[model samples]
Target: MPASLALSPTPAPARGRLWRTLRQWWAVLLFGAVAAVYALSPSSHDARSRNATARLLHATSWQALPWFALLSALISLALIRTLVVTAQSYGLSQFALEMVVRVLLLELVPLGAALFLLLRVALAGDLLPQADPAGGLAPHALAAERWRLELLPRVLALGFAVLALATASGVLALLLAYTVVYGVTPWGLDSYTRMVGRVFDPAVCLALGLKTGLFAVAVAVVPLASALQEPYAAARRAAGFAVRSGTRRVLAVLVLLQAASLALKFL
Candidate 1:
Protein backbone atom coordinates (compact mmCIF):
# COMPACT_ATOMS: atom_id res chain seq x y z
CA MET A 1 0.00 0.00 0.00
CA PRO A 2 1.14 3.58 -0.68
CA ALA A 3 2.45 5.59 2.29
CA SER A 4 -0.39 8.12 2.16
CA LEU A 5 -3.02 5.38 1.89
CA ALA A 6 -1.53 3.36 4.74
CA LEU A 7 -0.94 6.34 7.06
CA SER A 8 -4.18 8.18 6.37
CA PRO A 9 -6.58 8.10 9.30
CA THR A 10 -9.38 5.64 8.99
CA PRO A 11 -12.74 7.44 9.00
CA ALA A 12 -13.04 7.44 12.74
CA PRO A 13 -13.86 3.78 12.89
CA ALA A 14 -17.36 2.82 13.79
CA ARG A 15 -15.69 0.59 16.32
CA GLY A 16 -14.63 3.60 18.37
CA ARG A 17 -18.16 4.94 18.58
CA LEU A 18 -19.46 1.48 19.35
CA TRP A 19 -16.98 1.03 22.15
CA ARG A 20 -17.87 4.40 23.61
CA THR A 21 -21.51 3.45 23.63
CA LEU A 22 -20.75 0.14 25.27
CA ARG A 23 -18.62 1.84 27.88
CA GLN A 24 -21.40 4.29 28.65
CA TRP A 25 -23.90 1.49 29.04
CA TRP A 26 -21.52 -0.42 31.27
CA ALA A 27 -21.08 2.66 33.41
CA VAL A 28 -24.81 2.99 33.82
CA LEU A 29 -25.16 -0.65 34.81
CA LEU A 30 -22.27 -0.48 37.26
CA PHE A 31 -23.55 2.71 38.82
CA GLY A 32 -26.95 1.15 39.28
CA ALA A 33 -25.46 -1.93 40.94
CA VAL A 34 -23.34 0.13 43.30
CA ALA A 35 -26.23 2.42 44.13
CA ALA A 36 -28.43 -0.50 45.03
CA VAL A 37 -25.78 -1.99 47.24
CA TYR A 38 -25.10 1.32 48.94
CA ALA A 39 -28.74 2.09 49.44
CA LEU A 40 -29.28 -1.19 51.22
CA SER A 41 -26.12 -1.04 53.25
CA PRO A 42 -25.88 0.15 56.84
CA SER A 43 -23.99 3.35 56.08
CA SER A 44 -26.78 4.78 53.97
CA HIS A 45 -28.98 5.23 57.02
CA ASP A 46 -26.40 7.21 58.94
CA ALA A 47 -27.31 10.72 59.97
CA ARG A 48 -25.10 12.57 57.53
CA SER A 49 -26.11 10.49 54.52
CA ARG A 50 -29.76 10.69 55.46
CA ASN A 51 -29.57 14.45 55.94
CA ALA A 52 -27.92 15.01 52.58
CA THR A 53 -30.43 12.78 50.87
CA ALA A 54 -33.32 14.63 52.50
CA ARG A 55 -32.03 18.01 51.38
CA LEU A 56 -31.51 16.87 47.82
CA LEU A 57 -34.86 15.11 47.78
CA HIS A 58 -36.53 18.28 48.91
CA ALA A 59 -34.77 20.26 46.25
CA THR A 60 -35.68 17.93 43.43
CA SER A 61 -39.24 16.99 44.36
CA TRP A 62 -40.72 19.48 46.78
CA GLN A 63 -39.41 22.66 45.22
CA ALA A 64 -40.67 21.54 41.82
CA LEU A 65 -44.23 21.06 42.98
CA PRO A 66 -45.90 24.19 41.68
CA TRP A 67 -44.41 24.23 38.21
CA PHE A 68 -44.70 20.51 37.74
CA ALA A 69 -48.32 20.49 38.82
CA LEU A 70 -49.22 23.39 36.56
CA LEU A 71 -47.52 21.89 33.55
CA SER A 72 -49.00 18.46 34.09
CA ALA A 73 -52.48 19.85 34.51
CA LEU A 74 -52.27 21.95 31.39
CA ILE A 75 -50.96 19.14 29.25
CA SER A 76 -53.53 16.72 30.61
CA LEU A 77 -56.39 19.11 29.97
CA ALA A 78 -55.33 19.84 26.42
CA LEU A 79 -54.90 16.21 25.51
CA ILE A 80 -58.04 15.10 27.30
CA ARG A 81 -60.14 17.78 25.61
CA THR A 82 -58.76 16.96 22.20
CA LEU A 83 -59.36 13.25 22.59
CA VAL A 84 -62.84 13.75 23.98
CA VAL A 85 -63.89 15.97 21.09
CA THR A 86 -62.36 13.67 18.51
CA ALA A 87 -64.03 10.67 20.10
CA GLN A 88 -67.36 12.41 20.14
CA SER A 89 -67.07 13.41 16.52
CA TYR A 90 -66.24 9.85 15.53
CA GLY A 91 -69.11 8.42 17.59
CA LEU A 92 -66.62 6.67 19.88
CA SER A 93 -67.35 8.79 22.92
CA GLN A 94 -67.74 5.77 25.14
CA PHE A 95 -64.12 4.86 24.74
CA ALA A 96 -62.84 8.36 25.41
CA LEU A 97 -62.15 7.76 29.07
CA GLU A 98 -60.18 4.62 28.39
CA MET A 99 -58.19 6.34 25.70
CA VAL A 100 -57.44 9.27 27.96
CA VAL A 101 -56.28 7.02 30.76
CA ARG A 102 -54.03 5.03 28.49
CA VAL A 103 -52.48 7.97 26.68
CA LEU A 104 -52.15 10.49 29.47
CA LEU A 105 -51.78 8.50 32.67
CA LEU A 106 -50.08 5.35 31.51
CA GLU A 107 -47.86 6.92 28.86
CA LEU A 108 -47.35 10.64 29.18
CA VAL A 109 -47.10 10.89 32.94
CA PRO A 110 -44.01 8.74 33.36
CA LEU A 111 -42.27 10.08 30.29
CA GLY A 112 -43.08 13.65 31.22
CA ALA A 113 -41.82 13.12 34.74
CA ALA A 114 -38.56 11.71 33.45
CA LEU A 115 -38.10 14.54 30.99
CA PHE A 116 -38.95 17.13 33.59
CA LEU A 117 -36.37 15.84 36.04
CA LEU A 118 -33.83 15.41 33.30
CA LEU A 119 -34.22 19.04 32.31
CA ARG A 120 -34.13 20.18 35.92
CA VAL A 121 -30.90 18.30 36.54
CA ALA A 122 -29.36 19.54 33.33
CA LEU A 123 -30.18 23.12 34.13
CA ALA A 124 -28.68 22.74 37.59
CA GLY A 125 -25.42 21.50 36.14
CA ASP A 126 -22.25 20.75 38.11
CA LEU A 127 -24.25 18.74 40.58
CA LEU A 128 -21.09 17.12 41.82
CA PRO A 129 -18.57 19.23 43.65
CA GLN A 130 -15.00 19.58 42.41
CA ALA A 131 -12.69 17.11 44.10
CA ASP A 132 -9.05 16.32 43.69
CA PRO A 133 -8.75 12.59 43.22
CA ALA A 134 -5.05 12.77 44.14
CA GLY A 135 -5.48 14.55 47.47
CA GLY A 136 -3.71 11.80 49.37
CA LEU A 137 -6.91 9.97 50.21
CA ALA A 138 -7.16 6.31 49.28
CA PRO A 139 -9.21 5.52 46.18
CA HIS A 140 -11.69 3.44 48.15
CA ALA A 141 -12.22 6.14 50.78
CA LEU A 142 -12.60 8.83 48.18
CA ALA A 143 -15.05 6.72 46.26
CA ALA A 144 -17.06 6.06 49.36
CA GLU A 145 -17.09 9.72 50.32
CA ARG A 146 -18.19 10.76 46.82
CA TRP A 147 -20.95 8.23 46.82
CA ARG A 148 -22.27 9.03 50.25
CA LEU A 149 -21.94 12.81 50.10
CA GLU A 150 -22.75 13.54 46.47
CA LEU A 151 -23.78 10.79 44.10
CA LEU A 152 -26.16 8.82 46.26
CA PRO A 153 -28.18 11.77 47.43
CA ARG A 154 -28.52 13.26 43.98
CA VAL A 155 -29.44 9.97 42.36
CA LEU A 156 -31.94 9.09 45.04
CA ALA A 157 -33.47 12.55 44.83
CA LEU A 158 -33.90 12.38 41.09
CA GLY A 159 -35.42 8.93 41.20
CA PHE A 160 -37.81 9.94 43.94
CA ALA A 161 -38.71 13.06 42.03
CA VAL A 162 -39.65 11.02 38.98
CA LEU A 163 -41.85 8.73 41.02
CA ALA A 164 -43.53 11.57 42.89
CA LEU A 165 -44.16 13.67 39.82
CA ALA A 166 -45.52 10.78 37.80
CA THR A 167 -47.83 9.58 40.55
CA ALA A 168 -49.20 13.01 41.32
CA SER A 169 -49.63 13.97 37.70
CA GLY A 170 -51.28 10.68 36.87
CA VAL A 171 -53.84 11.08 39.61
CA LEU A 172 -54.60 14.64 38.58
CA ALA A 173 -54.86 13.66 34.94
CA LEU A 174 -57.24 10.81 35.73
CA LEU A 175 -59.49 13.10 37.68
CA LEU A 176 -59.43 15.78 35.03
CA ALA A 177 -60.10 13.20 32.36
CA TYR A 178 -63.15 12.01 34.21
CA THR A 179 -64.41 15.55 34.70
CA VAL A 180 -63.92 16.34 31.03
CA VAL A 181 -65.55 13.18 29.81
CA TYR A 182 -68.46 12.85 32.24
CA GLY A 183 -68.82 16.25 33.90
CA VAL A 184 -68.67 16.90 37.66
CA THR A 185 -71.33 14.51 38.84
CA PRO A 186 -70.81 11.85 41.47
CA TRP A 187 -73.04 9.44 39.57
CA GLY A 188 -70.47 9.11 36.79
CA LEU A 189 -67.72 8.16 39.22
CA ASP A 190 -68.67 4.48 39.26
CA SER A 191 -68.50 4.07 35.51
CA TYR A 192 -65.35 6.21 35.34
CA THR A 193 -63.66 4.02 37.90
CA ARG A 194 -64.77 0.88 36.12
CA MET A 195 -63.42 2.04 32.77
CA VAL A 196 -60.11 3.02 34.34
CA GLY A 197 -59.91 -0.28 36.21
CA ARG A 198 -60.60 -2.22 33.03
CA VAL A 199 -58.01 -0.25 31.15
CA PHE A 200 -55.36 -0.94 33.78
CA ASP A 201 -55.41 -4.69 34.16
CA PRO A 202 -52.83 -6.79 35.98
CA ALA A 203 -50.46 -6.98 33.04
CA VAL A 204 -50.71 -3.29 32.34
CA CYS A 205 -50.17 -2.46 35.99
CA LEU A 206 -47.01 -4.53 36.00
CA ALA A 207 -45.76 -2.92 32.83
CA LEU A 208 -46.51 0.56 34.11
CA GLY A 209 -44.63 -0.11 37.34
CA LEU A 210 -41.67 -1.56 35.49
CA LYS A 211 -41.64 1.25 32.97
CA THR A 212 -41.71 3.90 35.69
CA GLY A 213 -38.79 2.31 37.48
CA LEU A 214 -36.80 2.09 34.26
CA PHE A 215 -37.58 5.71 33.47
CA ALA A 216 -36.37 6.70 36.92
CA VAL A 217 -33.16 4.79 36.45
CA ALA A 218 -32.54 6.31 33.06
CA VAL A 219 -33.07 9.83 34.29
CA ALA A 220 -31.13 9.37 37.50
CA VAL A 221 -28.17 7.25 36.50
CA VAL A 222 -27.28 7.98 32.89
CA PRO A 223 -26.22 11.62 33.10
CA LEU A 224 -24.23 11.18 36.28
CA ALA A 225 -22.55 8.10 34.83
CA SER A 226 -21.61 10.00 31.70
CA ALA A 227 -20.14 12.87 33.66
CA LEU A 228 -18.33 10.66 36.15
CA GLN A 229 -16.77 8.55 33.42
CA GLU A 230 -15.17 11.56 31.77
CA PRO A 231 -11.84 13.02 32.88
CA TYR A 232 -12.01 15.58 35.65
CA ALA A 233 -9.22 17.57 34.04
CA ALA A 234 -11.59 18.92 31.36
CA ALA A 235 -14.67 19.11 33.53
CA ARG A 236 -16.42 21.82 31.57
CA ARG A 237 -16.06 20.17 28.19
CA ALA A 238 -16.80 16.82 29.75
CA ALA A 239 -20.03 18.20 31.22
CA GLY A 240 -21.19 19.56 27.90
CA PHE A 241 -20.50 16.29 26.15
CA ALA A 242 -22.04 14.32 28.97
CA VAL A 243 -25.21 16.39 28.88
CA ARG A 244 -25.60 16.11 25.10
CA SER A 245 -24.81 12.42 24.85
CA GLY A 246 -26.69 11.48 27.98
CA THR A 247 -29.78 13.42 26.94
CA ARG A 248 -29.83 11.74 23.54
CA ARG A 249 -29.41 8.26 24.96
CA VAL A 250 -31.99 8.86 27.67
CA LEU A 251 -34.51 10.13 25.12
CA ALA A 252 -33.86 7.16 22.83
CA VAL A 253 -34.38 4.73 25.70
CA LEU A 254 -37.55 6.51 26.77
CA VAL A 255 -38.97 6.37 23.26
CA LEU A 256 -38.11 2.72 22.87
CA LEU A 257 -39.68 1.83 26.19
CA GLN A 258 -42.85 3.73 25.36
CA ALA A 259 -43.06 2.07 21.98
CA ALA A 260 -42.59 -1.35 23.49
CA SER A 261 -45.35 -0.70 26.00
CA LEU A 262 -47.71 0.40 23.26
CA ALA A 263 -46.90 -2.67 21.20
CA LEU A 264 -47.53 -4.94 24.14
CA LYS A 265 -50.82 -3.27 24.84
CA PHE A 266 -52.25 -2.85 21.34
CA LEU A 267 -50.29 -4.87 18.83
Candidate 2:
Protein backbone atom coordinates (compact mmCIF):
# COMPACT_ATOMS: atom_id res chain seq x y z
CA MET A 1 0.00 0.00 0.00
CA PRO A 2 1.34 3.43 -1.01
CA ALA A 3 1.43 6.21 1.57
CA SER A 4 -0.60 8.37 -0.86
CA LEU A 5 -3.29 5.72 -1.00
CA ALA A 6 -3.61 5.64 2.84
CA LEU A 7 -7.13 6.41 4.01
CA SER A 8 -7.09 9.75 5.83
CA PRO A 9 -9.38 10.57 8.73
CA THR A 10 -12.18 12.20 6.79
CA PRO A 11 -14.13 14.52 9.14
CA ALA A 12 -16.35 15.88 6.38
CA PRO A 13 -19.23 13.41 6.68
CA ALA A 14 -19.45 13.62 10.47
CA ARG A 15 -19.19 17.42 10.45
CA GLY A 16 -21.78 17.62 7.69
CA ARG A 17 -24.17 15.48 9.72
CA LEU A 18 -23.54 17.66 12.78
CA TRP A 19 -24.23 20.81 10.82
CA ARG A 20 -27.40 19.32 9.37
CA THR A 21 -28.66 18.44 12.82
CA LEU A 22 -27.93 21.93 14.09
CA ARG A 23 -29.64 23.46 11.06
CA GLN A 24 -32.72 21.34 11.60
CA TRP A 25 -32.90 22.36 15.24
CA TRP A 26 -32.46 26.00 14.25
CA ALA A 27 -35.27 25.68 11.72
CA VAL A 28 -37.56 24.26 14.37
CA LEU A 29 -36.74 27.12 16.77
CA LEU A 30 -37.32 29.64 13.97
CA PHE A 31 -40.67 28.07 13.19
CA GLY A 32 -41.73 28.28 16.83
CA ALA A 33 -40.66 31.93 17.09
CA VAL A 34 -42.53 32.81 13.90
CA ALA A 35 -45.56 30.91 15.07
CA ALA A 36 -45.61 32.68 18.43
CA VAL A 37 -45.04 36.06 16.81
CA TYR A 38 -47.80 35.45 14.27
CA ALA A 39 -50.20 34.31 16.92
CA LEU A 40 -49.45 37.42 18.98
CA SER A 41 -49.24 39.97 16.16
CA PRO A 42 -51.95 42.17 14.64
CA SER A 43 -51.87 40.26 11.35
CA SER A 44 -53.53 37.27 13.02
CA HIS A 45 -56.18 39.45 14.62
CA ASP A 46 -58.97 39.04 12.09
CA ALA A 47 -62.47 38.10 13.16
CA ARG A 48 -62.14 34.43 12.31
CA SER A 49 -58.80 34.18 14.07
CA ARG A 50 -60.23 36.08 16.99
CA ASN A 51 -63.12 33.66 17.18
CA ALA A 52 -60.74 30.75 16.99
CA THR A 53 -58.69 32.24 19.78
CA ALA A 54 -61.83 32.69 21.87
CA ARG A 55 -62.86 29.10 21.27
CA LEU A 56 -59.44 27.97 22.39
CA LEU A 57 -59.55 30.17 25.47
CA HIS A 58 -62.85 28.57 26.29
CA ALA A 59 -61.61 25.06 25.72
CA THR A 60 -58.08 25.23 27.09
CA SER A 61 -58.51 27.70 29.95
CA TRP A 62 -62.15 28.36 30.83
CA GLN A 63 -63.28 24.77 30.75
CA ALA A 64 -60.42 23.78 33.00
CA LEU A 65 -60.76 26.79 35.28
CA PRO A 66 -63.16 25.33 37.79
CA TRP A 67 -61.16 22.16 38.24
CA PHE A 68 -57.89 24.03 38.50
CA ALA A 69 -59.32 26.62 40.85
CA LEU A 70 -60.77 24.04 43.19
CA LEU A 71 -57.63 21.98 43.13
CA SER A 72 -55.40 24.98 43.65
CA ALA A 73 -57.55 26.27 46.46
CA LEU A 74 -57.45 22.98 48.24
CA ILE A 75 -53.71 22.72 47.69
CA SER A 76 -53.24 26.27 48.87
CA LEU A 77 -55.24 25.62 51.97
CA ALA A 78 -53.17 22.60 52.80
CA LEU A 79 -49.94 24.44 52.21
CA ILE A 80 -51.05 27.53 54.05
CA ARG A 81 -52.22 25.49 57.03
CA THR A 82 -48.95 23.61 57.06
CA LEU A 83 -46.86 26.73 56.80
CA VAL A 84 -48.92 28.53 59.43
CA VAL A 85 -48.65 25.61 61.78
CA THR A 86 -44.93 25.24 61.18
CA ALA A 87 -44.35 28.93 61.59
CA GLN A 88 -46.42 29.05 64.73
CA SER A 89 -44.47 26.23 66.23
CA TYR A 90 -41.23 28.03 65.42
CA GLY A 91 -42.59 31.41 66.60
CA LEU A 92 -42.36 32.82 63.07
CA SER A 93 -46.12 33.18 62.72
CA GLN A 94 -45.75 36.89 62.01
CA PHE A 95 -43.95 35.94 58.82
CA ALA A 96 -46.37 33.19 57.82
CA LEU A 97 -48.54 35.23 55.47
CA GLU A 98 -45.51 36.68 53.77
CA MET A 99 -44.11 33.20 53.36
CA VAL A 100 -47.38 32.00 51.91
CA VAL A 101 -47.55 34.90 49.47
CA ARG A 102 -44.02 34.41 48.33
CA VAL A 103 -44.02 30.63 48.15
CA LEU A 104 -47.47 30.09 46.68
CA LEU A 105 -47.59 33.05 44.33
CA LEU A 106 -44.02 33.59 43.28
CA GLU A 107 -43.02 29.97 42.81
CA LEU A 108 -45.52 27.14 43.10
CA VAL A 109 -48.38 28.56 41.06
CA PRO A 110 -46.23 29.33 38.04
CA LEU A 111 -44.70 25.87 38.18
CA GLY A 112 -48.17 24.39 38.33
CA ALA A 113 -49.26 26.43 35.33
CA ALA A 114 -46.30 25.18 33.32
CA LEU A 115 -47.10 21.56 34.20
CA PHE A 116 -50.81 22.01 33.45
CA LEU A 117 -50.28 23.25 29.89
CA LEU A 118 -47.60 20.69 29.22
CA LEU A 119 -50.06 17.94 30.05
CA ARG A 120 -53.30 19.51 28.87
CA VAL A 121 -52.65 21.45 25.67
CA ALA A 122 -49.10 21.36 24.36
CA LEU A 123 -48.69 17.61 23.97
CA ALA A 124 -52.36 17.17 23.23
CA GLY A 125 -52.20 18.67 19.74
CA ASP A 126 -52.23 15.26 18.16
CA LEU A 127 -55.62 14.54 19.64
CA LEU A 128 -56.89 17.94 18.52
CA PRO A 129 -57.92 17.16 14.92
CA GLN A 130 -57.32 13.50 14.89
CA ALA A 131 -60.30 11.16 15.26
CA ASP A 132 -61.88 13.41 12.64
CA PRO A 133 -62.43 12.30 9.07
CA ALA A 134 -60.40 15.14 7.55
CA GLY A 135 -57.29 14.53 9.61
CA GLY A 136 -55.69 12.33 6.98
CA LEU A 137 -54.01 15.25 5.26
CA ALA A 138 -50.31 15.10 4.51
CA PRO A 139 -47.74 16.98 6.54
CA HIS A 140 -47.10 19.78 4.01
CA ALA A 141 -50.83 20.22 3.43
CA LEU A 142 -51.40 20.42 7.17
CA ALA A 143 -48.99 23.33 7.53
CA ALA A 144 -50.81 26.63 7.34
CA GLU A 145 -54.52 26.03 7.83
CA ARG A 146 -54.08 23.31 10.40
CA TRP A 147 -51.58 25.43 12.27
CA ARG A 148 -53.80 28.48 12.19
CA LEU A 149 -57.02 26.68 13.07
CA GLU A 150 -55.66 24.08 15.44
CA LEU A 151 -52.25 25.04 16.77
CA LEU A 152 -51.93 28.79 17.25
CA PRO A 153 -55.12 29.20 19.20
CA ARG A 154 -54.15 26.41 21.53
CA VAL A 155 -50.69 27.86 22.09
CA LEU A 156 -52.15 31.26 22.83
CA ALA A 157 -54.68 29.68 25.13
CA LEU A 158 -51.91 27.92 26.99
CA GLY A 159 -50.00 31.18 27.46
CA PHE A 160 -53.04 33.09 28.67
CA ALA A 161 -54.11 30.10 30.70
CA VAL A 162 -50.86 30.17 32.59
CA LEU A 163 -51.25 33.85 33.24
CA ALA A 164 -54.90 33.52 34.26
CA LEU A 165 -54.45 30.50 36.44
CA ALA A 166 -51.36 31.87 38.10
CA THR A 167 -53.01 35.18 38.86
CA ALA A 168 -56.21 33.53 40.06
CA SER A 169 -54.40 31.15 42.34
CA GLY A 170 -52.20 33.90 43.62
CA VAL A 171 -55.26 35.87 44.63
CA LEU A 172 -56.83 32.83 46.21
CA ALA A 173 -53.70 32.05 48.16
CA LEU A 174 -53.43 35.62 49.37
CA LEU A 175 -56.98 35.61 50.65
CA LEU A 176 -56.45 32.24 52.22
CA ALA A 177 -53.25 33.37 53.81
CA TYR A 178 -55.04 36.31 55.35
CA THR A 179 -57.93 34.22 56.54
CA VAL A 180 -55.72 31.60 58.08
CA VAL A 181 -53.46 34.15 59.67
CA TYR A 182 -55.90 36.78 60.93
CA GLY A 183 -59.20 34.86 61.17
CA VAL A 184 -61.41 36.96 58.87
CA THR A 185 -60.73 40.30 60.51
CA PRO A 186 -60.35 43.47 58.47
CA TRP A 187 -57.91 45.03 60.91
CA GLY A 188 -55.01 43.04 59.47
CA LEU A 189 -55.56 44.43 55.98
CA ASP A 190 -52.98 47.19 56.36
CA SER A 191 -50.29 44.89 57.62
CA TYR A 192 -51.18 42.27 55.02
CA THR A 193 -50.93 44.83 52.24
CA ARG A 194 -47.63 46.07 53.50
CA MET A 195 -46.12 42.60 53.74
CA VAL A 196 -47.34 41.41 50.36
CA GLY A 197 -46.49 44.70 48.71
CA ARG A 198 -43.04 44.70 50.17
CA VAL A 199 -42.39 41.16 48.97
CA PHE A 200 -43.97 41.72 45.54
CA ASP A 201 -42.10 44.87 44.61
CA PRO A 202 -42.10 46.02 41.01
CA ALA A 203 -38.95 44.11 40.20
CA VAL A 204 -40.27 40.92 41.73
CA CYS A 205 -43.55 41.33 39.89
CA LEU A 206 -41.72 41.84 36.62
CA ALA A 207 -39.54 38.81 37.23
CA LEU A 208 -42.53 36.64 38.08
CA GLY A 209 -44.34 37.81 34.95
CA LEU A 210 -41.28 37.15 32.86
CA LYS A 211 -40.79 33.74 34.43
CA THR A 212 -44.36 32.72 33.71
CA GLY A 213 -44.09 33.96 30.13
CA LEU A 214 -40.89 32.05 29.60
CA PHE A 215 -42.38 28.94 31.17
CA ALA A 216 -45.45 29.20 28.97
CA VAL A 217 -43.33 29.50 25.88
CA ALA A 218 -41.21 26.58 26.98
CA VAL A 219 -44.25 24.41 27.58
CA ALA A 220 -45.90 25.50 24.35
CA VAL A 221 -42.99 25.27 21.95
CA VAL A 222 -40.70 22.47 23.04
CA PRO A 223 -43.21 19.65 23.07
CA LEU A 224 -45.57 20.76 20.30
CA ALA A 225 -42.81 21.74 17.89
CA SER A 226 -41.13 18.39 18.32
CA ALA A 227 -44.38 16.46 18.02
CA LEU A 228 -45.59 18.54 15.08
CA GLN A 229 -42.80 17.46 12.80
CA GLU A 230 -43.29 15.19 9.77
CA PRO A 231 -45.09 11.88 10.22
CA TYR A 232 -47.01 13.38 13.07
CA ALA A 233 -49.52 10.62 13.77
CA ALA A 234 -47.11 7.74 13.49
CA ALA A 235 -45.03 9.51 16.08
CA ARG A 236 -48.09 9.41 18.32
CA ARG A 237 -47.99 5.64 18.24
CA ALA A 238 -44.41 5.84 19.42
CA ALA A 239 -45.39 8.45 21.93
CA GLY A 240 -43.29 7.16 24.77
CA PHE A 241 -40.07 8.09 23.05
CA ALA A 242 -41.48 11.37 21.80
CA VAL A 243 -42.71 12.29 25.25
CA ARG A 244 -39.40 11.50 26.91
CA SER A 245 -37.49 13.57 24.40
CA GLY A 246 -40.01 16.37 24.60
CA THR A 247 -39.92 16.36 28.38
CA ARG A 248 -36.15 16.56 28.40
CA ARG A 249 -36.15 19.46 25.98
CA VAL A 250 -38.84 21.29 27.92
CA LEU A 251 -36.94 20.79 31.18
CA ALA A 252 -33.72 21.98 29.61
CA VAL A 253 -35.34 25.17 28.32
CA LEU A 254 -37.05 25.73 31.65
CA VAL A 255 -33.81 25.24 33.57
CA LEU A 256 -31.98 27.66 31.36
CA LEU A 257 -34.70 30.28 31.70
CA GLN A 258 -34.83 29.80 35.46
CA ALA A 259 -31.06 30.08 35.75
CA ALA A 260 -31.02 33.23 33.68
CA SER A 261 -33.80 34.70 35.77
CA LEU A 262 -31.93 33.87 38.96
CA ALA A 263 -28.75 35.29 37.57
CA LEU A 264 -30.47 38.54 36.70
CA LYS A 265 -31.97 38.70 40.16
CA PHE A 266 -29.28 37.60 42.62
CA LEU A 267 -26.06 37.50 40.69
Instruction: State which candidate has the highest lDDT.
Output: 1
What would the per-residue lDDT of candidate 2 be over residues 1-267, giving only the tens digit for each residue?
A: 987678667668988998865754664586577676677677667777778889888877888889888988899999999998999899997787788888888878888877776667535544233322243232334456666776677667767887888788788888888998889789999988999889989989888988998898777666655555434446557556556656777777777877787688777
Which parts of model 1 have CA positions greater than 4 angstroms off? 1-12, 126-142
- C-alpha local distance difference test of each model: 0.81, 0.73
Worst 10 residues of 2 by lDDT: 129-138
Give model 1's TM-score versus the native structure.
0.89
| lDDT value for model 1 | 0.81
lDDT of 1 by residue, 22-51 (tens): 866876678778878787888776788889
**Inter-residue clash pairs, candidate 2:** none
Q: Which regions in candidate 2 have their CA more than 4 angstroms from the true location?
A: 1-24, 122-144, 230-233
